[model samples]
Target: MNEDSTPQSSTEPARPSSGWDRELLEKLLLEALVEQRKARRWSLAFRVFLVAAIGLGFILAFKPLAQGGLTAPSKAHTAVVDVIGTIAEGGEIDADTIIEGLREAAEAKGVKGIVLRMNTPGGSPVQSAYVYDEIRRIKKEHPALPIYAVVSDLCASGGYYIASATDRIFVNPASIVGSIGVIMNGFGFVGTLEKLGVERRVMTAGDHKAILDPFGPVDPAEKQHVQQLLNAVHQQFIAAVKAGRGDRLKDRPEIFSGLVWTGAEGIELGLVDAVGELHQVAETVIGAKEIVNYSHRETLLDRVIRQLGTSVETALTKLATSSPRL
Candidate 1:
């Protein structure tokens, strides 16, 4: 051994003190830590993905649990088409959907009868007429199959319009029955514009093009024209009700005067045939106990999109025209 050399133990190996080894060890440690962090992140991401997948599965699994799921029974049953909520174009209770449901129920095997489950404040006149016409056509095609309207909380205006087309109108004693009229309402913002010092300059090809413009002063001629239009629609509505109800409707002026009445009063006025709810109408009237829903139920995504579309459409329509409604 050299004089200055340090002696090593027989069992223990020599350890290096150079900075290179320390640097290498530190680099290895850093690499290991980074790998650990990456593994933890991957595990967390996987868990998040799993949770999201499970949530989606639950939504899909429970879709049929919603009222009036898009299905019918194999056995004899009363088909129900819900007319709940506003019955405007693009709405959940729109004419197209109602007509589709009616056609489906009429076509489906073992569907003894169809019940229009009415609970709406009513919406567009055109939409109402669409449904009413569809119901009449269905009745004409299927003379044996009885179609009935069962009013719940409310069945007014356009709602009643659709109901009138049914073979018989059943209602709860307290259910609101009628609003057989047409209206076109709006506000005149001319005074507000004057107070705000806002000048509205509008140009139109025709003289009556800007009729019922809220920002302009009410023109007597334009006002008269709008009134005439409303009256025309009102006559159409009256005609529909009279044609559907026929001799069942009482000879009363207030029936077509847009006055709402209770189910009992409606029966007296011949607006409703009897005082009965859905179950009663199904079991006693239709002679079917099992009630299968045939209504076109909207999915969550569909409802969201429909609501967005309806909002935009309504806003635009309000800006453009004060369209008549039932």
Candidate 2:
């Protein structure tokens, strides 16, 4: 057989040993390593970003955690106890809440005095009286600690009743004060029910169980009883004012006739000690240059929860407003 035509020996290889194969393998290995490094870096970055996001979420969830110790110190020598909104039971400015705040302020080591910030249209007489008593007790216990009441916008009725227990009352010139009286409000639906031929089947074991029921006719005896109770509350209110204001209060029945007066008139009538705002009382009257708020600060999470509750309340209010009156 010719040399070129004969098949190569089976044991001998005919392929060429080119360097391109080795070079290609090296390039693939390097590319793989680079890809691995990039993947590792991406994973690390993702982990870092995840941790940061979680931390931010926690901070947002618990705002108070971020504001740690902010409200720990009592501001200045004077602690402020804000009495905003209505002075009704179960309210933020109710007797229980105010009393607790006052007690805390009184017990705080840094607080030398208390400033009762009053801004309310007033509410339940019973609740107001409870707060008044608590204030008086605190005053008696801490005779040296001065308690000044600073009235804003409107401080009438029960609000004034509470202010009466303070050592001194300061009000802005346009602020409304006074209204030393008791009032109970309820609708009477007896006539309406009768006209509509609707019978109320309310039953009680006691004769006075339904004394103030709107669907029933108001008994003369019940009316007298309620009046007497209100009158008693009014007398207690008068006594508190007399004790606080002493000889300063003018001897006028009109003062206790549920008559609201401006701050200018109140000062003249001794219903208020002076006319001033909160800043004036804090800076000039109390002579405190720095203020530290000791009021309970809601955490970020708590504020969110409170906001949700307020939203619910607003919805309920809207629903009630839209509904037909009974």
Candidate 3:
């Protein structure tokens, strides 16, 4: 047989890969890589946000510690104690808080004098009385360290009661100084309930237990009893003012009433000693303008507000980065 005629075996052409194979594989790989990158970025961003939030929280938490130093003052400085907001039993300006500040100031070395920065509309008579008594006790214990109350926007009612116990009260000329009276306020909704056909159902063990309940009928005897109670409290309030004011108070019948007065008028009526602000009082009276606050840590309200701001920032960052850009 001729070499050429032996005839070579026919071999089939190699089949091209399936149309979907290369394209689909590349598409899937690209999609996976992109998704992985996005996931990584999101995770990094979330971690950053978390870290920033934590840092902010720490800053706010320790800010108060950085501001206050009871025993660390090596030089003469005016110790400040803030009595802001309502002076209630459970409030920040309560007896325990103020007393704590006063004690620290009493003990702090190089402290020439203490200043009570009061800005309150007043609350809780019992709380005020406690603070007043504590002040007198502190004065007796540390007669050298005088406490001066410096009033802000308002120092009325219980606020004034607390200030009265101090050696002197300094206030801004426009500051509201006094509301030397007690009041037990309530609302009577019986007429409204009757008009709306809303039946009132309330029970009490004692006859006079719910005397001030708005749903009940008015009792003349209860009213008289309440009035007498108010009168007794008023008398005590008057006595306290008289004792605190001593000869400084002028003979003014309306001074002990519930009427508020400006700082200027308060000075004229002997309710306030002089027109001055916190720093001014510190520089002039304490002879040390550098202030050192002895109050408690930063307020809960400040923390809440800061937390809310951080949350908003984190949310906005996530929203901006959640989607893919072109």
Candidate 4:
């Protein structure tokens, strides 16, 4: 062999040993690992930043979306409390509900003034009187807070009784105002029971226990007593109106003679302070440009719950009313 030829092995390069190959592979793998770690950190930071931004967005949107209807300004800090339907027992305008609504409105920090929006044809004297007393109490407690009553469709009898408690009363030009009186209505079923040969055996220790029973003949004395009571209630209503209206009331007995008047005539007769819509009254007269609804709001869930409760109560009432005599 030639001396120089000893230096040449093969044309192809020799394969590296396992250890050497592993070291080279490990070095490259470590470099790749370092790059992956850096990429992961950047990814984590970006994800965290995105999450924080989304969280902030949710926090900002939460209030407006949650309380959209309630938070929106109606141009006044005034709250509207609606008094609709009958004011009697089992009626929509019950004393408890009215008092609760008024109490909430009175206590609400956001509520600056109260607008009693009345639309009723009257109801039980007791129920009306209870609401009236509550209004008076709220007024006495929050003397600085102004309470304005706006008669919508009708504010007659018991409804007017409630409106009398407000600082000012405004009625729409077409609204029906006043019916200063008292009334009691019942059907006499004694003749029908007699015709049907249905004997109503009512045994009681007290002579007047069943005095007003519709199934029995009405006693003349009992009728007279009831009439006297009704008269007394009417006089009380008259006196309350007179006291509330003061000299604003045109001194006329016809005003309290169970006569309902139109909003225009009511203004002339001093049954109402002025004739205007609720918005106009709030904006122009009261100087409260913004309106907040202090009325009791029943959500769908609340309504469902209330309906269930009402059903249960009705069932109980039916059971009680249909029960046999004691």
- The number of the candidate with the highest TM-score is 1
For candidate 4, write residues 115-136 as lDDT tens digits: 8889999888788888888888
Task: Mark the 10 consecutive residues where model 1 has the least summed lDDT.
Answer: 317-326
Question: What's the ranking of the predictions by TM-score, best on top?
Answer: 1, 3, 2, 4
lDDT of 2 at 245: 82
Q: Which digits, one per residue and each the tens of the lDDT, describe model 3 over residues 80-129?
A: 98999988776656888888888888888888898999999989888888
Ranking by lDDT: 1, 3, 2, 4
Give per-model TM-scores.
0.72, 0.68, 0.70, 0.67
lDDT of 2 by residue, 1-326 (tens): 67889875688767876899889988888888777766765665566556556655765666655555345364556688888898777665677778878888888876767888889999988898898889889989998788889998999988888898888899999999998888888999988998999978987999898988988888999999999998987888888888878999988889989899999999999999988777777778777644545454345665665665565456545534542221
Which 10-residue span in candidate 3 carries the lowest summed lDDT?
63-72
lDDT of all predictions, in order shown? 0.87, 0.79, 0.85, 0.78
Q: Give the distance in Å from residue 85's predicted Cα in candidate 1 to where it truly belongs.
A: 0.9
Task: Report per-prediction Cα RMSD to one decimal.
Answer: 13.1, 15.5, 10.5, 19.1
Off by over 4 Å in 1: 1-70, 301-326
Candidate 2 residue pairs in clash (backbone atoms < 3 Å) = 63-300, 64-300, 75-292
- CA lDDT of 268 in candidate 2? 90
